[model samples]
Target: MNKRMTGVMAAGAAVITLCASSALAAAGRESSADMRGVSVLVGGGVEGYTRGLGADIQPGAAYGATVILRPTKVVGLELGYAGASNNFDRSNVAVSEATRGPDVMRNGGQAVATLGLTASPVQPYLLAGLGISRYNVRATAAGFQDDTVGNVPLGGGLRVHLGHFTADARINYNVLVDQQLATDLPSTSATSSTGGIYTGTVNLGSTF
Candidate 1:
């Protein structure tokens, strides 16, 4: 893990701990029905890289799992892990055969706070969080260096609750910081050091 990733993970841990403590304290004053329990979700979707990363990586399939802890009907915290497989765009004829590389695997972890607009069966929510992303590519003759970066994810989604089951459609726009991919291409400037990722997913889960 890079320094930025390590810092994000530490900050996330602190925020989660504080939120959990606050939730426990509030639970004592709230009715059982008003406190939503924990939920686990599994989902898959597509992700597109933008800016620097988009120049070399192709959009691809993404999958993830999430754990949500709702202390109150309208407030919750989410821990999520997601991964995507993206192919290198080799259309650039200037690229030498030796510089060409295999598929790239992108993985990320996030800790987010969510706020629901309403407590009805159908709820719309906003989320913002801190996250870390890692981009791994198999070493090539050109000696590409893998990178890890910290990110901020911001987005919103709608959730439908049916008895103990829930379904959600969510999208997140991730801003990546200090992302340096050391491809060391011959003619072109090395890959961009900053980029963005657009992700959307549909998740189904059960509340306990």
Candidate 2:
């Protein structure tokens, strides 16, 4: 499933890029082929696990770097890596099984499509992407053995550009798509919940 999703995402990204470039060419915006730029972003944010897991996971800080390729002023492709550590929320869930709930090491890479609302310096954009997240959960009691799955991230935000400086803020929800993650969990168990993540971040970057 991960392999198939990756291929579909790559194909989809290509189609979107082609259509965007063609539209820009028809609009006479500096020939999409000739107009190209790159940006490097540094960002930090908070995220949390949501779903039916053995234990409640607390929201935690996350940070990552992203490189953007802008083929046109209004269209860009982004590739990034981010990771966060979440501890089980012991206050709400039962922790008697061991000492703590499952400890998870979440990390992944994402390919995204960004569409700017305008070509101006201060532009608002919408973005959505596909990612494969490795959810390393240590829960011997709940029967969750597998560790990785696909994600659907939906988000939008504003980008402020000033000379070589760029800044942006965004919020997103990452939905996990695989049901087999709970292959070991009993069907009646609450730990068999489908998990997701929510994040909000601000970034500072430089464009060249």
Candidate 3:
């Protein structure tokens, strides 16, 4: 009889131990699964960019957000928006046979879509995206006037996650698709342009 009682107690202890182990493993799995989901973030910041023929545009304010659909631990799709203004600087001068002079400034907004690859929870990533931009140029002699433009930008950047939010810095070499000539300027004046838009951007966002 004593032998039978000892055996029963041993069996009960074994079952309890197995149940505890199972519970711990289940909790660990849930924690890992939480890493994969839809995250929405918004941020406002700045960028330095250029827009038409030669390299000459200044920095301006920019703001935007990214919505990420993370399917796995390392892959996702990010839909983002960014807007920046271009202010002209005389230091951006070109030497030409026509003339050497100051020109107009340009600024605008961009809507973008990117596919990204992440390496960690607080990850640094790379993205290839397309941007739809509306550019406006303002000359000091005249008020602010603008031209609409479209571009395809292939780029990459880094992101840092701090609990509820993330901060990012990115650079894009935007190739303008539509080419518009500014021949209306006085024929004797130097025909310098803003150039293909190249941008360096930084923004902050929070996840919900």
Name the top TM-score candidate.
Answer: 1
Question: Which digits, one per residue and each the tens of the lDDT, describe model 3 over residues 1-208?
Answer: 1243334335434543443344335534334323346667555443444443333444544456667766765565776665665445445533132222323333434445444464443444566555565554444322223555566666766554444444555666766654342333222122224445545555555544
Once superposed on the true structure, which residue ranges of model 3 sit more than 4 Å away at CA? 1-35, 44-46, 50-55, 91-118, 140-145, 162-164, 181-194
Error of 1 at 152 (Å): 0.5
* Candidates arranged by TM-score, highest first: 1, 2, 3
lDDT of 2 by residue, 135-206 (tens): 776544244444677777788876665556666677677766663455543333222245667766667778
* Whole-model lDDT values for every prediction: 0.68, 0.65, 0.48
Q: Taking the tens digit of each residue's C-alpha lDDT, what string does model 1 give over 50-133?
A: 765666666777789999999878898999998887666666313344434346778889999999997755567999999988
CA RMSD, predictions in order: 11.3, 10.9, 19.6
Which has the greatest lDDT?
1
Which TM-score value belongs to model 1? Answer: 0.72
Model 2 spans > 4 angstroms off: 1-36, 53-55, 92-102, 138-146, 179-193
Which stretch of 10 consecutive residues in model 2 shows the poorest summed lDDT? 184-193
- Of the two candidates 2 and 3, the one with more favorable TM-score, higher being better, is 2
- How many clashes would you count in candidate 1? 0
> How many steric clashes between backbone atoms does each model show?
0, 0, 4
Model 2: lDDT of residue 163: 52
